[model samples]
Target chain A: MQPVYEVHKLSKYYGRIRALDHLDLALAPGKLVGLLGPNGSGKTTLIKIGAGLLTPDQGSVLIGGMAPGPATKAIVSYLPDRMALPTEMTTKDVVSMYSDFFADFDRVKAQEMLRDLHLSDSQRIGSMSKGTQEKVQLCLVMSRAAKLYLLDEPLGGVDPAAREYILSTILRNYSEDSAVLFSTHLISDIEKVLDEVAILRQGKLLLHDSVDHLRQEKGMSVDEFFKEVFRC
Target chain B: MNWNITAGRPVYVQLIEQLELAIVTGEYPPGSRIPAVRELAAEAGVNPNTMQRALQDLESRGLLQSQRTSGRIVSANQDTLHTLRVQRAEVYVADFLRQMHKLGYTQEETLELLQKATFPTVSNTKEES
Candidate 1:
C-alpha cells in the first residue's frame, strides 16, 4: 500500500521549545489510526502539521506524495477539538461557507446530516449550547468526501451523550476509501474502532501497528501494553 | 458485535487460545451455538470490539463458523480444534516437565504429581491442598 502521509526527519519548534523532534512516519492508506498520548505530547502539533494548518521548521511532510498545499488541503478534512464557528452565523450559513471554500464539500450531505441531527437550519450557532455547536461542527467536517480526515480531540470536553453522538457520527460517516486520523487520550473508548494506531510519547513515535498485530505480538491487552511500555 | 475490553497483543491471543479450549472441551461443543459478541464481552467484562475481533480471528482460523441469523457457532468439524489442542498441550506439558526437572524431579515423579493433581475423580479437588 502507498503511504498516504509521509514524513522523514520532521521537526517543529515554537520559539525555544521543541514541539516535535526528528519525527518520522509513513502512513498506509485505508486506516483509522489513533494518535495516543497525554497532553503536550505533540499530538496536537503532529495533527496540525498533517492538516496543513502548521508548517514544520525542518524536514519534509507529504500528503499523497505532495507537499501540504491547496491540493492537499482540498482532500483533507479537519475537525478541531474546540468550536471555531462564527457565533453570529446560522447553521445553514456554516454549511454554505464550507460549500464555498471546499469543492469536495457536499452541501446535500451536510443538509441531510443537519436534518438527521434534528437541528433547524435557522438555529444560530451562538443560540445553541456548546455541545450542540460541536454537533454542527462535526456535521460540517463529515460533509466533505475527503481522502484524509483529521479529528483532533473530537470527543474531548464533551458530555457523555454528546460523546456518544460524536463517536457514532464519526463511524457512520466514515468511508472505506478514506483514512481518519483521530488524536485523543480516550484510548479505551475508541481503540476498538481503530484498525491501526501510532502511539506518541514526549514528542516522539513510540509504537505504530495494527491493533490486532500489536495484541498478537505482545500477548497483553493494548491498555496493559500501553501501561507497561509507557510506565512512569 | 461489540466488546468492551482493550484489544491488544498477548491478550487477544490469550483470548483466542481460551476460546479454542472451550471449543475443544465442549464448553462450546462442535455444532453448538456460540455466544454473541455482546454476550461474550459482558461475560469477560471486555470491550465488545475485543470479542468481535476474537470471533473474527476464530472465523479466519476456520475453527468457528458464523451465520447471519444464528451469529457465530462452533465448527461442526473438530479437526482444527483437535490439532490446536494437541499443539498447546505439547507446549504446556513440555513446560511442566522442564519445571519438574529443574526442581530435581524425575519423569516418573512428574507423572505421579500430574496423576494426583488433575485426577478428575478427586471431586473435592482443592480441599486436599
Candidate 2:
C-alpha cells in the first residue's frame, strides 16, 4: 500500500536559515505519528510543505501517492498552528462553508461534534475563547473524510482536559484507511496515543521509529528520551 | 474499562496484558465479539496500529479468533481460559512472594501471612487492629 504521506530528499531554506535539510519521512495509513521537535526545529515547515501551503525548494513531498496539489489538498485536512477561521462567521456558517467547499466534508458529523463539545452553532468565532475556537477548527478539519490529517500544534494553548478531548476526537474521527501526523513538543501528553514518532532537530530528521520500540530499546519514555537528546 | 498505561514501558506490551486481563476476567466474555481494532484504539486513546498489533498478538496466542467476515472474537475454549486464569494468578503470587522476600520475610512467614489473608475469619481478632 502507498504511504499516506511521503517526503523524499525534501529540502527547504529561508534566506540564510535552513528550515528543512534533505528530510525524508513517510507516514503509512492506519497510524498516528508524532512529529516531535522543539521550537524552530522545522516541524512547522515540514507540515506546511505537506499541507501544500509552502512549496519545497528541492525534492518532493507526496500526500497519498500524489504530489501536493489541488487533488492532494482535497484529500488532506490541515489544521494550522493559528486560528484561520473567519472570526465573524458563526459556527454553523463555518460548517456550511466547509460543506460547500469540500466534497468530503460531513456536515452532520461536524454538527454532532460541535454539539458534543457544547459549542452553540450560532456562536460567533470571535466571541468564543481561544480554546473553543481551536476546538471548532479541529471539528471542521476532522469532519472531513480525508485520507491524511496534518495537525500542527493541535494541543498547544489548551487545558489538559481539552487536550484529552481533542486527542480522542482525532482518534475517533479519522478513518482507519487514513493517517494522522500531529506535531507537538508535549511529548508526555501525546506519547501514549502515538504509534510512531519522528524526532527533528535543527532542520534534521534525528529519529523515526515505533513508540513501543523506542521505549523497549531505550528503557525510557519518549519524553525522557526527547529531553536527553535535546538537553542543552 | 479504564486502562492504566504507564510510561517507560512498551505500550503494545501493556495493551496486550490489559486486553488479556479483560478477556480472562470476562470483561470481554468468552465467545463474545470484540470491538474492531480502530474502535478499541480510539476508546483506549492509543494508535490503531498499536491496537492491531496487540490484537494480533492475542490471536497468535489463541486467546482471540478472527473470522474473515465477522472480525475478532474471544476464544471460546474453557480449558484455555481456565489455564490462562491460573497462569495469571501465579504471576501475582510470584510477585507477592518476591515483595515479601524483599521485606526480609521467610517463605514460611509469607505462607502464614497468605493463609491469614485468605482465611480472614480465622484471624479476625488480629485484623481488628
Candidate 3:
C-alpha cells in the first residue's frame, strides 16, 4: 500500500535560517504519529510544508502519491497552531461554512459534537473561552472525512480535562483508512494516543520509530526518551 | 476497567496485560464479544493501531478469537481460561521472587518470609481460642 504521506530529502530556509534540512519521513495509513520537538525545532515547518502552506527549497513531499496542491488539499485537513476561524461567526455558521467549502464535510456530525460539548449554535466564536474555541476548531477539522490530518499543537493551552476530551474525540473520529500527524511539546499527555513517534531537533529528524519498539529497546517511555535525547 | 498506564513501560505491553486481566477475571466474560477496536482505544485513550496490536497479540495467544461478522470474543474454552489464570499467577510469583532476590534474600529466606507472612492470621486466631 502507498504511504499516506511522504517526504524525501526535503529542505526549507527562512532567509538563511534553516527550518528543515534534508528531512525524510513517511506516514502510513491507519496510524497516529506524534510529531515531537521543542520550540523552533522545525516541527511546525515540516507540518506547514506537508499542508502546502510553505514550499520547500529542495526535495519534495507527497500526500497520498501527489504533491501538496489543490488535489492533495482536498484530502488534507489542517488545524493550525493558533485560532484560524472567523471570530464573528457563530458555531452554526462555521459548520455551514465548512459544509459549503468541503464536499466531504459532515455537518450533522459536527453539530452533534458541538451539542455534546454543550455548545449552542448561537454561541459566537469570539465570545467563547480560548479552550472552547480550540474545541470548536477541532470539531470542525475532525468533521471532515479527510485522508490525512495535520494538527499543530491541538493540545496546547488547554486544561488537563479538556485535553482528555480532545484526545478521545480524535481517537473516536479517526478513520482506519486515514492517518493523523499531530505535533505537540507535551509528549507525556499525548504519547498514549500515538502508534509511532518522530522526534526532530534543530531542523533535522532525530528518530522515527514505533512507540512500542522504542519503549522495549530503551526501557523507558517516549517522554523519558524525548527528555534524554533533547536534553540540554 | 481503569487502565493504569504508566510512563515507565511500553503502553502496548501494559495494554496487553490489562486486557488479559480483564478476560481472565471475567470482566469481559468467557465467550462474550469485546468492544470494537476503535471503541476500546477511545476508552483507553490510545491509538487504534496500538490497541489493534495488543488485540492481535492476544488473539495469537489463543486467549481471544476473532469472528468475521461479530468481531472479537473472549476464548470460550474453560480449559484455556483456567490455564491463562494459572499462567498469570505464575508471572506474579516470578515477579515477587525477582524482587526478593533484588533485596538480597536467597530462595530459602524468601520461602521463609512467605510462610511467615501467610501464617500470622492463623496464629492470632489460635491465641484467641
Candidate 4:
C-alpha cells in the first residue's frame, strides 16, 4: 500500500544547526509509529515540518499526496509538545471551536470523552491544572477523525497517571484507516503502543522497523539495544 | 497490565511475551483473574487499545481467557510459556556469543566473564556497594 505520508530526503536547518538531515519517513494507514530520539535529535523538527509549522531548508515532505498545505492540514491532526489552546477559553469553548474549524471533528465523541473522564465543561482552561489542560488538549485532538495524527511528545513531562490517560485517549480515538506518529524520549512508557518505531540520533535515522522484527532478529529489548547502539 | 515494556521486540508481541512470562512466573496464575485491560493499561502507563490487542492475542493463543464481566484470566496450561522461553533463551545466547566474539574475548576470557557474572567469588569484592 502507498504511504499516507511520504517524507523524502528531508533536511532542515536552524541557522548553522541541522535539525533534520536527509530524513526519509513513510507511514502506512492505521499504523501507530513511535518516533524515538534523544534531545535535539530533530523529532520535533520533523513533526513541525510535517505540520507545516516549519519549512525545510531542503528536501520534501508530502502528506496525503500534497505538500504540508491546507489540503494536508485538513486530514492531519497535530499535537505539539505544549498546549496551544488559548488559556482564556473554557473547555466547552475549545470543543466548540474545534467543531467549527474541523468539519470532521466529532462533537459527540468529545462530549462522551469528557463524560467518561467526569471533567466539567464549565471549567475554564486557565484555572485547570497543567495535566488537566493536557487532557482537554488531547480530547480536542483525538476527537477529530483525521487521516494522520502527529502527536509530538504525547507522553512527555506528564505524571504517570496522566501519561496513561493520554496514551489511552490516542489509542481509543484513532481509527484503523488513520495513522498516528508520536514522538518522545520516554521510550519505555509509550513503547508498548507503537507497532513500528523510528530511532533518530543526531538528526539521522539509525533504525526503522516493526518492533517484533528488531526483537526477533536481535533478541533484546528496544531500550537495551538503544543503549548499546548509542553507547558512547 | 502496568508493565513497563523492557523487551526489544515489537510492542504487541513484547506485551504478549511479558504477560506470558507473568503467567509462567505465577505473577498471574492459572484461573486467576488478571487486571482489566483498562486497569492494567492505566497501571503500566500504556494505551488501553494497545493493551487490549495484547490481551486478545494472548486469549486467542490460549495463554489467557477473557470473560465478559470478569475480565481476562491466565490460561490453565503453561506449555506455551515454556516453549517460548526456550526459543528466546537460545536467541539471547547466540547474540551473547556473537558479541563476545566481536569484543575479542577468547574462550577462557568469556568463561571468566561468565563465572565472575554468575558466581561472584572473593575476587569480586569491588567495595562499591
Candidate 5:
C-alpha cells in the first residue's frame, strides 16, 4: 500500500538557515507518529511542507502518492501549532465553517465533542480560555475523516487534565484507515499513544523507529531515548 | 482497570503483563468476551495498534482466543488459566528472593521470614522473644 505521507530527501531553507536538510520520512496508514525536535529543528517546517502550506527547496513530500497540492489538501487535515481560527467566530460558527469547507468533516461528532467539554455553541473563540480554544481546535481537527492528519504541537500550553482529554480524543478518533503525524514537546505525556517516533536534529532526520522497538532495543522509554539522543 | 504504565519499560510489554493479570484474576473471566481493540485502547490511553499487539500476544499464549462471531474471549481452559496464575505468582516469588539475596538473607532465613509473615495484613506482628 502507498504510504499515507512520504518525504524523500526533503530540504527547505530560510535564506541561509537550513530548515530541513535532506530529510526523509514516511508515515504508514493506521499509525500515530510523534515528530520530536527541539527549537529550530524544522519540525514546523516539515509539517508545513506536508500540509502544502510551504514548498520545499529540494526533494519532495507526497501525500498518498501525490505531491502536496489542491488534491492532497482535500484529504489532509492540518492543525497549526498556534491559534489559527478566527477569534470572532463562535464555536457553532467554526463547526459550520469546517463542515462547509471539508466534505469529510463530521459536524455531529465535532458538536458532540464540544458539548462533552461543556463548550457551548454561543461561546466565542476569543472569549474562551487558551486551553478551551485548543480543545475546540482539536475537536474540529479530529472530527474530519481525513486520510492523513498533520498536527503541529496539539498539546502545547494545555493543562495536565486537558492534555489527558486531548490524548484520549486522539486515541478514540484514530483508525486503521488513516494516519496521524503529530508534533509535540510533551514526549512522556504522549509517549504511550504513539506507534513510532521521528526525531529530528538541526533539520536532519535523527532517527525514526517504532516506539516499542526503541524501548526494547535501547532498554528505555521513547522519551528517555529522545532525551539521551538530544541531550546537551 | 488502571493500566499503571511506567517509564523505562516498553508500554506494550506493560500492557501484555496487565492483560495477563486481568485474565488470571478473572477480571476477564474464562470464556468471557473482551472489548474491541479501540475501546480497550481508549480506556488504557494507548494507541489501538499497541493494544492490538498486546491482545495478539495473549492470543499466541493461549490466554485469549479470537472468534469469528464473538470477538476476542478469554481462554476457557482451566489448566491454562491455573498455570498462568502460578507462573505470575512465581515471578513475584523470584523477585522477592532476589531482593532478599541483595539484603544478605540466606534461603533458610528468607523461608523462615516467610513463615513468620502474615500476608494481607502487610505488617510484621511477630514478637521477638
Candidate 6:
C-alpha cells in the first residue's frame, strides 16, 4: 500500500536558522504515528508542510500521491496547534462551517462528540476556555473522514482526563484506509497507543520504528528511549 | 478483563500475554466468542491495530480461530490449552530456578524451601474446600 503521507529530503529555513534539515519520512495508512521531538526540532514545521500551510524550502511532501494543494487539502484533516476558530462563532456555527468546507466532514459525529464533552452547541468559541476550544477543534478534525490526519500538539494544555478522552476519540476514529500523524511532547501518555514513532532531533530524522520494535530493541519505553536519545 | 499494559516492552506482545492469560484462566472460556478488535482495543486503551496484531498472532498459534459466522472464538482444543498451560508453567519454574541459583541455592534446596513454605490464605482455602 502506498504511504498516506510522504516526505523526502525535506528542508526548511527561517532566515539563517534551519527549522528542518533534509528530513525524510513516510507514513503508511492504518498507522497512528507519533511525531516526537523537542522544541525547535521542526516537528511543527514538518506538520505545517504536510498540511500545506507552508511550502518546504527544498525536497517534497506528498499527501495521497499529490503535493499539498487543493486536491490534498480536500483529503487532509488538520488540527493546528493554536485555536483557529473565530471567538464569535458558536459550536453549531463551526460545525456548519466545517461541513460546508469539507465534504467528508461528519456533522453528526462532531455534534455527538461535543455533547459528550459537555460542550453545548450554543456555546461561543471565544467564551469557552482554551482547553475546551482545543477539544472542540479536535472533535471537528477527527470527525472528518479524511485520508490523513495531521494533529499538531493535540494534547497540549489539556487536563489528564481530557487527554484520555482525546486519545480514546483518536482510537475510536482509527481506520485501516487512513492514518493519523499526531505530533506532541507528551510521549508517555500517547506512546502505548501509537503504532509507530518518528523522532526528530535538530531538524533531522533521528529514528523511526514501530513502538514495540523500539521497546524490544532498546529495552525501554518509548518515553525512556526518547529521553535517552535526546539527553544533553 | 482488566488489561494492564506496562511500559518497556512491545504493546502487542503485552496484549498477547494478557489475552493468553485471559484465555487460560477461562475468563475467555474455550469455544466462547471474543470481543471485536475495536472493543478490545478501547477497553485496553491501546491502538486497534496493535490489538488486531496480537489477536492475529494468537489465531496463528491455534489459541484462537476465526469462523465465517463468528468473528473470533477461543480454541476449544484441550490439548492446545494444556500445552499452553504447561509452557507457561515451565517459564515460571525456569525463572524461579534461575533466581534460586542467583541466591546460591541448589535445585534440591529450592525444592526443600518450596515444600517448607506455607501460605495462610492457601491453607485456609484448602481447609474450607
DockQ leader = 5
Query: Residue A166, candidate 5: how far off, in angstroms?
Result: 1.3
Measured against the true two-chain complex, the DockQ scores of the candidates, in the order shown, are 0.09, 0.61, 0.65, 0.18, 0.68, 0.57
TM-score of chain A of each: 0.93, 0.97, 0.97, 0.95, 0.97, 0.98
Give the C-alpha interface root-mean-square deviation per candidate: 6.9, 1.4, 1.0, 3.9, 1.0, 1.3
DockQ, candidate 4, vs. native dimer? 0.18
Q: Report the TM-score for the A-chain of model 1.
A: 0.93
Which sections of candidate 4 miss by over 4 Å? B1-129
Kindly list the per-residue Cα lDDT of model 4 for residues A1-94, writing each as its tens digit: 6687889989988888989899888998877888887889999998888889998888988888788888888999998899888999899999
lDDT of 2: 0.89
Off by over 4 Å in 1: B1-129
The CA lDDT at A100 in model 4 is 92
lDDT of 6 by residue, A116-159 (tens): 98998999999999999999999999999999999999999899
For candidate 3, write residues B1-129 as lDDT tens digits: 777877776778999999988988899998899998888988999888888989999999888999998899987478878888999999999999999999999999988887788454777979888
**Model 2, which residues run further than 4 Å from truth?**
A174-176, B118-129
* Total backbone collisions, model 2: 0
Q: Which window of ten consecutive residues has the lowest lDDT sum in model 2 chain B?
A: B118-127
Could you tell me the lDDT of residue A1 within candidate 4? 69
Candidate 1 lDDT score at position B9: 38
Better of 2 and 3 by DockQ: 3
Which docking category, incorrect, acceptable, medium or high, applies to candidate 2? medium
Cα RMSD to the true fold for all candidates: 8.3, 3.2, 4.5, 9.2, 3.7, 3.5
True contacts kept of 6: 0.64
| Worst 10 contiguous positions by lDDT, candidate 1 chain A | A168-177
Residue A75, model 1, lDDT:
88
Tell me the deviation in Å of residue B52 in model 5.
1.3
The per-residue C-alpha lDDT of model 1 at residue B51 equals 57
Alpha carbon deviation, residue A195, candidate 6 (Å): 2.0
TM-score winner between candidates 1 and 4: 4
